[model samples]
Target: MAITSANQLELLQTAEAVAREKMIDPDLVVQAMEESLARAAKSRYGAEMDIRVSIDRKTGRATFTRVRTVVEDDMVENHLAELTVAQARDYLENPEVGAEIIDEVPPVEMGRIAAQSAKQVILQKVREAERDRQYEEFKDRAGTIINGVVKREEYGNVIVDVGRGEGILRRNEKIGRESYRPNDRIRCYIKDVRREVRGPQIFLSRTDPQFMAELFKMEVPEIYDGIIDIKAVARDPGSRAKIAVISYDGSIDPVGACVGMRGSRVQAVVNELQGEKIDIIPWNDDAPTFLVNALQPAEVSKVVLDEEAERIEVVVPDEQLSLAIGRRGQNVRLASQLTGLDIDILTEAEESERRQKEFAARTSLFMEALDLDEFFAQLLVSEGFTNLEEVAYVEVDELLVIDGVDEDTAGELQARARDYLEAANKKALEEARELGVEDSLVAFDGLTPQMVLALAKDGVKTLEDFATCADWELAGGWTTENGERKKDDGVLEPFDVSLEEAQNLVMTARIMLGWVDPTELEAEAEEEAAEESSEDATEETEA
Candidate 1:
């Protein structure tokens, strides 16, 4: 085809048609047409020449031109595309080193092969523009719910036509028993929107916990209006789930609001979730209290929480134990997820047995370490004396508070406890030195003799080694691997070193070695305090 007056307006019509069909900007299609024409012109003109084409938006007239840049004589690598500054007088009055000289040229008569190549270039550019438009439209819709019509299923994954673009519902993200046919209306959560090489992918999910929360928000007026907030959600996908909600308005009960009249609101969510059961519980700031509510229908006898470890123990009646754990541990597992804590459920009898075992163990430790009889050790353990260090350093008045203990007896007990601790510390120091522990590490404050021996055994002998250690490495931490939490043994954890104490000890060692500057730390602390104060003032003003 040739560029003629009869087909001058055809380019704009084609661009607009392509843009409207693809839901993209018309200017992008026009630019793509221009580049395709330029590429075809380059094939007809000398390949070494810089042939450019521009299409008029108003008239659709295509203009072809060849450009040669004026350059220094030594920089003229391509004579067809570049002109030396001294040899450019024919086209310019004064050609500078970086000036461009342009001349009009006739458009190329695109042959069959050239027209096909131009068509491919235009299609590629249009496809890229379509992808960009799709990504832009859906990226902010992530974490939201969308309603779409199922287009088809490929390899167990359902593809839905989400209005302007297509979204994918992977097999694992579908409710286990839920299946869809072509053209079926479906609702799903927009789990993520990703830009891939092929196109922008919209990932939809029905198994996400947030999907349930969004369903409640849609079904319940109180949640939609922010009178009640969904604090947490845990789903077992097509089986069961737990949702924690808190009401800002005291007159409204969060759980009752979520349940609605005759369980209307929650039932709507459950129906959408393929008949999955939902337990709507009132939210509490206190973790143990919240956990108790999460594990509903099973009364708790006692609750023991380890805040640092994010662990909880729930003691229930023997009969309620089975109910608390549910079928195959689903109840407690969902409760653990809802509370963000690891849970251990024990029956009352089991808890009592465990307590008795702990008491006997502590009594035995006191009996052997303090050289006391079982009766004396039992008294000490009953009075909350768990270790020899507490007995050795405790005030005589505290020992006197125990039964049948006079001032002389307290004195003798303290003397014996101190003598045993001293002997143990001396032996630990000897063993640590034998393991190549340096005096600098031993002299560091906050670390006991036993802690030093532990570090030495773990190959952290020198002060530098101690300074380089991570806080978690010295405090024993938990790690999640493949959805299960595993415990990482810390070298000094047996000595009861908390993470904060470990960090402080390491920082002190670093300061002594001049590896870190104290002034910079102080400056950072001051900056953080200032930022916190500013934020508090802003919040107070808003309140």
Candidate 2:
């Protein structure tokens, strides 16, 4: 039995009802049917065959039209075919020999095969419409926090039903050490929303720093109301977190607001994070003090910052070193990331020892070469030359720029400086040799051959030069006419030594060369003094 027109109308109504339930547009379905029919006709019929199909959106009416060309000769059905003059006259009252004719064909009864084809077209259109609707719905929801029910687990990832669509929470994006079960209610931050061929894909993350920030916003009313603003957040999710907050209103304590009364607010966030610790620090413009606070639970005694290197050395107490470093150095590491600094932690004892060693090293170098007092050490510090090596290698003009040092004084200092450096290097070499060290001149790059020759000619070649030369004599006559020390002037200006400097130099050289024993020299002086006293007593007795 053939179906009536009413039956076709009933079928169209049924398809529209299904589309509405599936969130697919009815017009889009009808358009898909028409397009499918045109494709099917082209595939089955020749390309030259002109065919048009249309479907009524409101009514269940479909129509097809076939267009044919009018020509002089009959060659093909649609391309070069033509109707005789009598037939053309019957169709048109007056028709030209070369004119075309378009004839309307009655709608073909959609048989079983054709009906099946139309149904496939309708289903495909409905799916495309649904995908478009989903893409448009979720594209604007990125970065929003949403509550979802666990749908299923796939490849160690949890698929969540977020009302509109399913969002995948990857394993890495899940909070550390936290697990999810099927149908579990969880809140996650929407990390991304992407349009795929099938539909919109939403990505959820519980490990994102913004997740904690949004949680704080929800738990702390002051934040959501805009009285307090969270400036920054850093997390080692499932462990510890640091958040910097500022207040828009001067009267409000941003930290206190986030902490709530008796720690109720922050505790709520902590509970959500499975009891992970949170450090709510107030935002400060002072970098050093701010960093000190950022590395909390381990009090910082001092912070030496290198802005150019984006590095900071933090000094804490000996007892707090482990705390500052945390388990596997996590504390300091996170603090470094939070403050955007490369942090090096040192205990107070370590820092003090370092400073003392540095000071002693500098003092040893300056005292040996420059004939300088403690005042010179203070000057070197002010000039940013904290070590004796710097003083030994730097030019006299550079030293003169230091306050309390003049060109003449710098010249005298420089002249004595080379002698001091040579003595220091000789002492270091001797000590290294005694210790069976292979690299005796490891740090003696500043001791040039000319400097060694100058000190040698002055008799100040060993570590004992200071003991041999009087401070006044060494300081008084060390400069030339131009107030420049005669330092290693190859053949033009050979290094010269004054009588007093030469005497001191000789004593130093004798000690270094092992020609005179230091202990024997002291004993000989005591013996000579006793003999002179005994002789004076004998002369008195004879008289």
Candidate 3:
């Protein structure tokens, strides 16, 4: 087929029109043709074949020129079969051994295969350019929420048509127990956007943590403006969630703002979560207080902190124990996680017992001592001075400083105070030793002989130490090794050192020394002392 200039101009015009319709630059189209023609020439002729295509914008005429190497031998099959130097000189005035000669290969009409190959090349390049453009467009949108229409459902997954491309809402990412029909308009978080072989593949999610955060951002203006911050969040999707919040501005209440008036704001967020309950707890730096608040509807009376064990014992009324513990311990469990502490719930009874123990420990007396009616005795109990030595060490002025005690009483008490204090301390040491209290008297520095003797006379000997001594034995006083009164004098001391005092002193010593503790020792001591005094009075009257 002989190509006329008119035919060539018509082909170029057709190429130009196709390039414009495809939105491909004219220069690029020309470049693509040149590369295609070069490839086609090489395949037909050999690697030695070189070709270039030229398009004239005015006439739209396209032409092809082929260049050949001037070689000495015909050893190369291609490039005009390598013309000899003598033959090459006939065409050129000066010819180098490696120089190439240019020639025009009368435009060979592209065969069907060549035309198809060129068309494929143009299409491939155009498609790649479009993909690059799309990838650049969507890459910036990753991690953002986008509104899209549900285009179709395939195998339980929804394909959303985002304006620029398509996004997949995987079955797992969709809210469970909810259904979406085709063309349903839904908002989803764009987890990722990447270029794939087909086009930009956008991955959308509705269950991501960012989804919850975004909901808060939409519903709470303060959060969007950065006035309030969400400290931490834990969620059981479609069920419940706990979000801790704080504010940079001291005056702002982060929780209240997030909750909104009548909970309208938070309710809106809850609705989006498909009725998932949201707990907006105020973030607290104090772990104990924070945990107390975390377990809502449960009032806490006290919190025993065990920092080393990372555990806390929370005491609530008997009626509130169940509430504090929640359904299957859910309340406490979540509270523990939120506060990063292990929580144990205690009822009122347990708490009372604990308080009694703590009081005994502080007073250095048995819980029984608390029952004592004597003002001075009770004062000693309150001060944790169970034995005479503790009292002896207490300054008279100091005693006077105690609430309800005047200087006159403190002075009078101090006058007869030493003997009583010594006796009380001795009784405490013996009781502590008998009870096998660990480290008993090992660290006690101010014990006196009088206190030890007095403690023994009260039957607070080893036998009485471990077990509660009878009132008669304590009042009558214990026997010495030779069966005589334990006291130096046959007559028991006239001063008032009641059996209750003896008991209280022993218990207090035990506590101060980190020994075993029962209950209010002072109360029981007073009762025993009163009974003994009554019995003694009756015996004297009979005599």
- What is the overall TM-score of model 2 with all chains considered together? 0.64
In angstroms, how far off is 485's CA in candidate 2? 48
Task: Write down the worst ten-residue block by lDDT for model 2.
Answer: 487-496
| TM-scores, one per candidate | 0.94, 0.64, 0.50
Tens-digit lDDT track of model 1 for 1-543 = 898898989999999999999999999999999999999999998789999999999999999999999999899999999989888988899889899999999978999998999999999999999999999999999999999999999999999999999999999999996789999999999999999999999999999999999999999999999999999999999999999999999999999989999999889998999999999999999998999999997899999998878899999999999899999999999999999999999999998998899999999988888788999999998999888889888988999999999999998888888999999999999999999999999998888899899889889999999999999999988999999988888888888788898889888889999999999999999999999999999999999
Question: With candidate 2 superimposed using the best TM-score fit, by how many Å does residue 197's alpha carbon deviate from the native?
Answer: 3.4
Each model's lDDT: 0.93, 0.72, 0.68
Which candidate tops TM-score?
1
Tens-digit lDDT string for candidate 2 (392-449): 5787778888877887777676667666767766775565455433232222333334
Top-down lDDT ranking: 1, 2, 3
**lDDT for 416 (candidate 3):** 54
lDDT of 3 by residue, 129-149 (tens): 656666787799887788999
Q: What order do you get sorting by TM-score, best first?
A: 1, 2, 3
Quality of model 2 by C-alpha lDDT: 0.72
List the lowest-lDDT window of 10 residues for candidate 3: 483-492
